[model samples]
Target: MSIITTERLCKYFKGKKALDNLNLEIPKGIIFGYLGPNGAGKTTTIRVLLNLAKPTGGTAYILGEDIRKSRNYLRKVGFLPDVPNFYNFFTAREFLSFIADITDIENPKKRIEETLELVGLRNEKSRIGTYSRGMKQRLGLAQALLSDPELLILDEPTSSLDPQGRKEVLDLIYSLKSTKTVFFSTHILSDVERICDRIGILKEGRLLLEDSIENIKKRYWKRRILIEVDDLEKFLERIKESLKPNSVEVKNSSVVIEVLDIQYTLKEIPKIVVQDGLLLEKLEILEPSLEDIFLEVTSGA
Candidate 1:
């Protein structure tokens, strides 16, 4: 089931369009990566979904309930905004306890301790004012999940973390995916690639593409064959004769070929390589990454 959806969603600021006629469906119980460059409207879309901000035109739904009408639905969602503010005077444990109290949660001491450990900040019992930016972000995440929410909306979830801190948070977020739905928005493509089951690429306030990781790679990116042939001239000639025009390029005694059908190319490549008496030093298919797809879609080049 689709836990989050937006239909022709549009959000305008004064006269500027931040989100334009956007349509998206995020499946339940899966990590949906919302990707875009800065000012691409990723945060705007998220805000609308949470009902933190109203949309100018169109509608949004979360957990099958209209976002505008379902104020109580917020209880089922955990939100970590790009920048999370807190009472710095409060210690880590105290801050968590405050949230638990406001949410009317029972037995919050145990829950607070559990969440603190879950974020790998169990040892930091000092005031939050002394914590690092990364620690604050982790604390924000801990608070978001304190309710044991069914849906998590995270914006730049790892933006403030060091490598180790980021990894710890990511591991925690991934662990939660088994039981909760996550909508992770970030400009960091690598993070999305690591944890996202499906991704939507938004650019200039519009969703340019939305698809599974596998489907995006298959549709816009393909595996390439890199071959090292013994006789450069002969190998080049044979490839030209046997392969489609402009498909093969010879570079430094290595031939890189772009083929539409990987299986057919694999079958035919060995024959051509052998006939040309190539060394076969390295023959492998290399697929494109999410970064590659992101550049292609956003640049319009």
Candidate 2:
């Protein structure tokens, strides 16, 4: 069953359309990735889904209930916003304790300790203000996990972190999938490629694409041939002889060659190089990376 669903969801601010007929369905136990560049409605969609802001049109349901009318439905959800705010005077422990109490979590003390440990903040003895950005992020994650909620919504959870801090957060998020559904929204395309089972790409407030990461790559990402040679001029001439016209673009000794048919390209490559008597420094099949796809999709918008 889908833990979250939106049908033709739309949101607008003044005269701007933040979201336009957006549709999303996230199944339980999947690490769903919501990806888009800034102002693409990723956050707006999240806000509407979480009931933080009402949608201007359409409807959304979370955990099988209408979010707009059911305030109690929020109890089963946990969220970490892009910039999580906390009481600077409160200690990490105290902040989590406060959340537990407010949420009416059973066994609040044990839950707080477990959540802190889960986020690897169990040993950090500092007030919220004293913590580093990474540490604060961990604390925020601990609070989100305190109730062991069924659905976890995170927006840019790893953004602005150092490499080590990013890894720690990614590791923690990866570990939570066995027990809860994760709806992760981020512009970090690589993170989505690494952790998401399914991804929804939103652009200009519409879902441009959604599929398993592998399938998306297979469908939208094409394999191309990269040829780095010692003889730039000769290689170009040789490619012109038998290859499709205008299929290659050269930059010095390297050329970006779009492989029309993988098998045919591989077969013809060696012949073309040999015909030119050029020494191939490197000949590789380049699959589209997430960065490549992100650029291709968003650049035109």
Candidate 3:
């Protein structure tokens, strides 16, 4: 089941198109990474989906209810913006208690205790003012999950944290996948690679690609072979004419080449090396990374 759907959803700001005819669907019970470089309308899309900003064209549905027509979906979602605010002077338990009272949650004490424990802040008694940035982020997550909303919307959740803090927050998000559908939006490729099952790449307010991480990588997979030889100069001259590869570069001891035909290159390189009387030191296939895929698709393809 789709937890979120957008059909030709668009948002314009002061004669600029922030989102242009975006069509997206996020399935239930998975971490959906909304990836893009800066000014790619990631935040704009989130705002429209949350109904925080009205779209200039088209519409969206969250939790199966049309966002334009019903507000019932809002309560089913929890949001954590890039920068989360807190009552600096309030204790973790105190602040959550206050939120619970305002929201009329039953058995606030038990729920608050469980959430704090889940976020690794159960025993923490320090006032929020005394907390570190990481601690504050944990508290913010505790607040967001206190309601136990079905879908969690996070914007750059770890962009501002130190290495340790980023790990802590990411671990927390990864742990919630079975219980909540996480809509994770960020430009940090490594983080997305770590926890996201699926990703949608956006550029200039248009979604360029959306698929499972493995499938996307496979579809864009180009063979990159690292070949090291005794005669670098001679092999370079011969291979260009014979292999006709997409690209070839010398990196330290190895010459990395993206081959057009893996079978041909693998079979032909040995013969060329023998003909050129060059020593074949090493020949290995290099794996494609998410960064490589992101750059390739966003740049043109």
Candidate 4:
């Protein structure tokens, strides 16, 4: 069963639409990346799913139950917002303890210790105000996990961190796949590529594309073969005479051939090069990166 599902979900503010007939389904035990540029309504969709905002139209469900009808499903979910606020005076242990009490979690002390360890804050004894941005983010994640939720929703969880901090958080997020379903929204395409199992791209309050990383690459991206030879001109002529690629261009010291049929090109290029007596220095097929795909899809280019 889908852990989360939305049907023609719509949300409008005054006359502006934040979401327009957005339909989505996230299955269990996958890191689902919600991707879009700024103001693409990713956060709006998340808010609607969490029942933090009333959708102007349509429906949404979590754990097979409608959020509008019952908020009980919230107990099974955990959320980490883009910018998490904490009581500056409270230590990490104290703050989490406070959250546990409010949420009525049983065995709060044991849960807090386990969660802190999970986020790599087991030894942190300083106040929240003294912590770095990365530490604070980790602490926020610890609070989210205190409930031992089945579904974890995060909004741009690594937006402001440095490279090391991003790595830390990403590693922690990746570790959740065995135990939780993660649905995170981010404009960081590389992060999506690194950890996401499936992704949805939103643009102008609408879903532009949604697919697994591999399938999306195969479906939307063209394969370009980059070949470096002893002589660029000779190889270009050989390519023209033998392969007849859709497009061919000399880039720096190499020739890049764009082909419609990857299998045919791969099979035929080596034979042509060998026959023409051209020295092959490097032969590689360049697959389009997630960043490339995101720009092309969102820009409609």
lDDT of each: 0.87, 0.86, 0.90, 0.91
Stretches of model 2 off by over 4 angstroms after superposition = 274-277
**Per-residue lDDT of 212 in model 4:** 95
The candidate with the higher TM-score, 2 or 3, is 2
Residues 73-102 of candidate 4: C-alpha lDDT, one tens digit per residue: 998999998888899999999999999998
**TM-score list, all predictions:** 0.94, 0.92, 0.90, 0.96
Residue lDDT tens for model 2, 97-216:
889889999998888888888888888777788888888788878888888899999989999789988988998899888999999999998899888899998898988888888887
**Model 3 lDDT-worst window of ten:** 74-83
The lDDT ranking, best first, is 4, 3, 1, 2
Between prediction 1 and prediction 3, the one with superior TM-score is 1
Compared with the true structure, the alpha-carbon lDDT of candidate 4 equals 0.91
C-alpha lDDT (0 to 100) for residue 125 of candidate 1: 77
Ranking by TM-score: 4, 1, 2, 3
Worst 10 residues of 1 by lDDT: 239-248
Tell me the tens digit of each residue's lDDT in model 1 across 72-156: 7788999998988789999888888988998877899899989998887888979898988888899899999999999999999
Please write out the lDDT profile of model 3 over residues 224-278, one tens digit for every residue. Answer: 9999998898999999998888998889877999987898899999999998889
